[model samples]
Every structure is written in structure tokens, then in C-alpha cells.
Target: MASLGIVLHASLICIVLLTFFSGTASRNIANEILQRLEMVEKLNFDLKKENSNLKLEMIDIKGELKDIVNEMKVWMKSRHSQGNNKMNESNSDLQKENIKIKLEMAELRDQMDNVVRENCEMKKKWNELDDILISVYIHLNKSKPEIQSGIMPEHRTPLSYQHVAENRKANSVRSVQRIVPPAPDVTEQPVAFYAYMDSYHTPGLPIHTTLIFDTVQLNDGHGYSKHDGVFIAPRTGVYVFHWTIQTEVHSWESIEIVVNGSPIGCAASDTLRINDYGTGSGLVATRVNTGDLVFLRTHESISGYLLSNHRLRSSFSGWLLYS
Candidate 1:
């Protein structure tokens, strides 16, 4: 009974050990399968993500293609429009060229016709002139030679008549010569002091006198004198006096002068001073009337002073335009 009991206990112990080992192996197998299933699930999730991304990229590509197609259509339409415009322009230009050519041809034809007409007219005129010239020549050739010689028949003249005619012609020529006055001497007034008295003056006016001095002699100290001034009645008139003073020095002051007292005409003074020794002029213009006196005043004192080759000349000429 003791040996049997020992066998039974050992048997029970061995079965319990076997059962525990089998359960451990089964647990390991189950864990390995579960790990493989988890890996597969992760791979599927990654594939789904990749597929979604690819779909989005495809949509973008399709949109770009649509834009390219639209742009192509627009470019084609523009090209077609441009082609139509070019064709119309070409047709219009051709019409204009044709019209211009026709107009030019018409103008040329008109010019040719005008030239032909003028040529005919000129030829006709030339022929008529030629005929006239021929007739004139023939007529001149037929003229009498004796008449051309200026001779007359004796019956046309008497000796006494001829003598009287000649005498009358001589008398007529002499009469014509007498009627025509001789030319007044224009030779410059004698180179000397010329004086005119008021005796030849008009009434109610101071005697107007003109004195022309050929030259002023500084050596003689003869220039302006108090009494030299002219007296004219008081009246309104344009008075002009010109005095030309010539000197050897170009830079001389107060060479020519004129002075007027009360009721004097417009008074003017002119002086010419050049840096070079040449011709210079001085002028004075004044309006004066009756009882007015004008005189020449000398400003410079020089011993060698003498009127230039032209000589010192003083002239007073004026008329009373109004009283």
C-alpha cells in the first residue's frame, strides 16, 4: 500500500508539470501571432496615407492642364483676328493704289492735250508774223527814190520865198535863245565873307541878313561879335542853321557854336568828337522870329586856328511859316 501511494503521487506531479509547459508554449505562440497582426495593421495605415496624397496631386495636375488649354484657345483667336485685319488692310491699300494710278494717267493725258493745243496756236501766230514782215519789205522796196532823197521840184519853191524862209528860221532861233535865260553861276560863292543886308527884307519884320564866312581865322581873332547876331521880328517859324567846324585835332571841345536870345526858334546842339583826327560836324536847330538875334560864340583860344581847307562856314536860312 505504501509503494502504490508513492507511485500515484509521482504520477500526479509529472502530469502537472507537463500541463504547465504546454500552457507556456501556447501563450508564446499567441503573443507572436498578435505582434504580426499589429505590424500588418500599421502597413495598411501607411498605404492609405500614400493613396490620399497621390489623389490630391492628380487633381492639381488636371487643373493645370485646363489652364493650358484655355490659354491656347485665346492665342488662336488672337491670331485669327490679326489675320483678318491684315487681309482687309491689304485690300484697301490695293484699291487706293489703283485709284491713284488712274488719276495720274488722266492728268498726264490732259497735259499732253494742252501742250498740243499751245503748239498749234504758236505755229499759227508765227506764220501770220512772217507774212506781215514780207509785205512790209515789198512796200519799202516800191517807194520812190527821189522822194527818199528829200528833193522837191522847182515849181514847189520860189527863190525869194526860200531866202525869207531861211531868214525867218534864223530869227526864230535867235528869239528862242533870248527867251531861255542863262544858267545861274553855281560856282561856290567867292571864298570870302559874304553879307546880305535887310534892305531886301519883307515888311513888319527885322531885316534878315545872311553872312557866309569862307574861313575863320584864329590868327586874326575874327569870329563872333556882339553886333554880328541877326535881328528878326518876333514870330513863330522853323529855323535851321548849319555850321561845319573843321579842325586838325579830333579831340577838341567847343569848336562850333551857335547862341540865340529871346524868341529864338528851337535850339539844338551837335558835337562830333572822334578819337582819330578826321572830319567832324556840329549842328544847331532853333526857331526864331522877328527881333530875335542869333550869334556865334567862340569857346576856344588858339593862335594857329584857321578854318579847315573847307573853311569856317555859317549859314542862316529860314522863313516865317506863321505870324
Candidate 2:
């Protein structure tokens, strides 16, 4: 019985030991499970943190892309504006050049017009000169025929009754009658008298005097003295007159008669002074018309006595007189 009891006690001790060991094992297993849980939670937290950082990197990249796009747009707009400006400047330059060319063309046209006008005026003057030369040539040619004809006679002679009688005596009456008179004589009265006297000298005679010109009057026989020193013509025709004068000394004295400021006749004496009286007498028969004023004029100082002789003459010679 004692042995059985001891065996039971030992078995109880073994059982207790086994139970302690089981408890220790169970404790270790629980500890291991708790550690494994802790590790899992840490790994989960790490994964979540890495995911958030990746999301932040993606947002920054998107912002940078937006800025690049905006910059490119601004650059393009500036380029476009520059291009438009260049085009406008080119157009303005072209317009200015065109206007300048037009002005130059207008000036050239004006110059051409002036040149053409001058040429036409010169042509007209040349034509007028040519016409004048042609007229002069025609006049000279017409006169050639008259100069060739022998209708004119030679020698100058007076055609009067006394001249005819003398010619009849020289040649026979038949020959004298066959010869025609050179000029025809007509009876003419004095219309106006023109007298000229030399300058007055202390002891000299007058240079010239008119005899018939002083004696004849317009209505009847009336003589004119030195006081009435002028004569006016009443009618228009040729008149005859004679002049005579005596000088005691020789001198360069001249007398001139002018009508309408034109000299018609003049007498001059160029002789030395002498104690005896010297006479210088002449007859001037001139054809004077109406409206002619006659006066006396002298060239040098002279003074003396004047005497005129009555003589009849013809005034058929050519003399210009104003009417």
C-alpha cells in the first residue's frame, strides 16, 4: 500500500511539471502573435506615406507644364505683331516713291511744252524774213525792163519861145519844127517870198536880198520892207524869185531859207574884205505850194546895204514844199 501511494505522488508531480511547461509554451506563442501584428501595422503605415509623396510629385509636374504653355503663347503673339509692323512700313515707303516719280514726270512734260512753243515762234519769224526778201527781189526785177528801154533823152535844155527862135536860126525851120520841146512853160504868180540875211557886221553889206519876192503881193503890186520879214503862201503851186546883194568885205557868211524846219536854199560868201563894194547876186526859181511859211535866216554876223533886181524866171525845178 505504501508503494502505491508513493507512485501516485510522483505521478502528480510529473503532471504539474507538464502543465507548467504547457503554460510557458502558450505564453511564447501569444507573444509571437502580438509581435507579428505590430510589424504588419508598421509596414502598412510606410506604404501609405510613399503613396502620398508620389501624388505630390505628379501635381508639381502638371503646374510646370501649364507655365510652359503660357510662355509659348506670349512669344507667338509678339512675333505676329512684329510682322504686321514690318508690312505697314514697307507699304508706306512704296507709296512715297510712287508720288515722287509722278512729280518728276509732270516737270518733264512742262519743259517739253516750252521747247515746242519756242520752236514755233522761231519758225514764224523765219517765214516773215523770207517774204520780205522775196518782195525786194520782185521789185528789182520789174525795174530792169524800164532801165533797158531807150525812151529817155540826153542833155538838159529850156523849152521857151526865145530858145525856139535861136534854134531855128541855127538849124533850118523844117529841122527846128521837127524837134519837140523838152519842157512846157506855164505862167505862175508868186505865192510866198523867202529871204535870208547874213549876220550883222559894223561896216559890211547884207549877204542876200530878194527882188521879185519882196515886190510881189498876194492881191496887187506891194513891196515888203525889212520890217515885214516873213511871207505866207496863199495858194499851192511853183513860184519864181531872184536875190541880189553887195558886200564891202570878204567874209564867211551864209544865209539859209528853211520851210518846215527843212533847208530849201542857201547862199554863202567866202571872200576877203575889200574897200570896193562886191556884189553876189543869183536867181532861185523854186516851185512852192500852199501852207508853207517863209522866213529869213543868216549864218555869221554881217551888216550892209542890199539891192535886188527884178528878173523873171521859171520854177519848174524839183523842190520839196509842204502844203
Model 2 residue 205 distance off true place after TM-score fit, in angstroms: 81
| Model 2 worst lDDT window (10 residues) | 174-183
lDDT per model, in order? 0.39, 0.44
Question: Candidate 2 on 109-179: residue-level lDDT in tens?
Answer: 99999998996675465446434433443343234443223122234333432344344334322121011
Q: TM-score for each prediction?
A: 0.33, 0.30
| Best of the candidates, TM-score | 1
**lDDT by residue for model 1 over 169-235, one digit each (tens)?**
3442111110111112213211111222221111111111122232223111111111222222222
Error of 2 at 289 (Å): 43
Over all chains combined, what TM-score does candidate 2 have?
Answer: 0.30
In model 2, state the lDDT of residue 6. Answer: 50
